[model samples]
Target: MPELPEVETTRRGIEPHVTGAKVREVIVKRHDLRQPISPTLSTIEGRKILSVARRSKYLLFGIDDGSSVMIHLGMSGSLRVIAPGEAWKKHDHVGITLSNGKQLRFHDPRRFGLALHFTLPPEEHPLLKGLGPEPLEETFGVKYLRSACSTRKAAIKLVIMDAKVVVGVGNIYASESLFRAGILPQTAANTLTLPRLKRLTSAIKEVLADSIEQGGTTLRDFLKSDGEPGYFRQKLFVYERKGEPCLKCGTPIRHAVMGQRSTYWCPKCQR
Candidate 1:
């Protein structure tokens, strides 16, 4: 699935073309995705897009009438902007035609993406209401992470990846951040010291910011709105480097299954 950086990249790539443009039409090629395409989405026609933003892995399109459109690019999904007459490819599930003669198209071969309209304050929507603070925000600091970890007996990696603890730390990022902090993935969350927690928090922020700067890590189906694959995967430290020499210590990188997700770490470097 696309993580925060991938979603943010898509938001940035499409914002220049979509923001402030009037919607000429809203097209839904399929009503079934991870969730049903909301019928309210039809109201997007004739509305002006005010802004494009991201929350966690979801894209938010603020409209002129105070409502918003929320989209989630589930596994194997992507969004692109094409000319008005561009031929539709397979799995192009949704399209928003702009008055400027461009179309914002959504494609998800797995049919796990979502398109929904929010008439209420978007922040109050069911999907957004209880999400944790954005990991890149100043509010998600060492102190906050320490507090969140103190109450969880789960593995440190799983705790950090919990959306309720801090949003957007997916499996790939959790492994990379833990490796960067020299913390083993299976360490008990509540057992981490304050100093170690500080290191982990900083690593999380640094890794996430760097990934966003590099346009996100593309292990599989993620793509920027312009249809470019992210280059950050080339810079990975431990995730998916199983059996390869650790970049820091030359010890073979190890792999394990945690919470049903593949985890990679340096057995020697990451205690």
Candidate 2:
């Protein structure tokens, strides 16, 4: 699945190409995505794209007609910019042709992504209303995270992964951030001291910023809008290292299952 950084990278990659470009047409090859692509999605055909923004892992396209288009790149989805009438790939599920003679295509082999159109304020959307703060934003500092963890007895890793606690800290980032903060993934959330929570808060922001800088970690299904694979995978210290030697301590990295997701850490480095 495309995590926060991957989605942010996509937003940055496509923003310049699509911004201010009038939509010449909307084509839907498969409406049966995670959320059915609404037939009315074509209403933006004649509207100009004003801006592109990201919240959590969703891409928000601001249209001139007071409506917005939101896309979620569910497990295996990706967006690409190509020439108009470009040869379509096997999973090209949707396309938006622009006045600039470019076509924005969405591809998802697993059919788990979504493209929806709405006129309401973006934050009011049901899928977005309950989300916690963006980790990179100033609102998600140590005090905020400390409060959220104060009452939770779940494993620290699981607590941080909760979207209601903090948006965009997916399984990969949760593991990576925990490793950076020197915290065991199995530690109880409420048992963490203020200093530990402070370290954790900073670690989350740092890991995410680093990934976005590297265009996000490409672990199979993700690709930038230019179709380039993200290079962050090379910087990973844990996550998928499994039994590989820890880069910092030479201790064999440990792997386990937490919240049904693969978890990795350096046994000696992360206490």
Give the TM-scores of the predictions, in the order they appear: 0.98, 0.98
List where candidate 1 sits over 4 angstroms from the true fold.
none
lDDT of 2 by residue, 60-166 (tens): 99999989999999999999999976898889999999999999999999999999999999999998999999999999999999899999999999999999999
lDDT scores in order: 0.91, 0.93
RMSD of 2: 0.9
Model 1 scores a TM of: 0.98
lDDT for residue 224 in candidate 2, whole number 0-100 = 94
Off by over 4 Å in 2: none
Looking at model 1, how many pairs of residues clash? 0
Put down candidate 1 lDDT per residue, 1-271, tens digits, no spaces: 8998888888889999999999999888889998999998989899899999988888999999999899999998999999868888889999999999999999999998889887888778898889899999999999999899888899999999888889999999999999999999999999999999999999999999999999989858888888989988999999888899999989999998999999999978887
Lowest summed-lDDT stretch of 10 residues in model 1?
218-227
Top lDDT hit: 2
Candidate 2 lDDT for residue 195: 94
**Clash pairs for candidate 1:** none
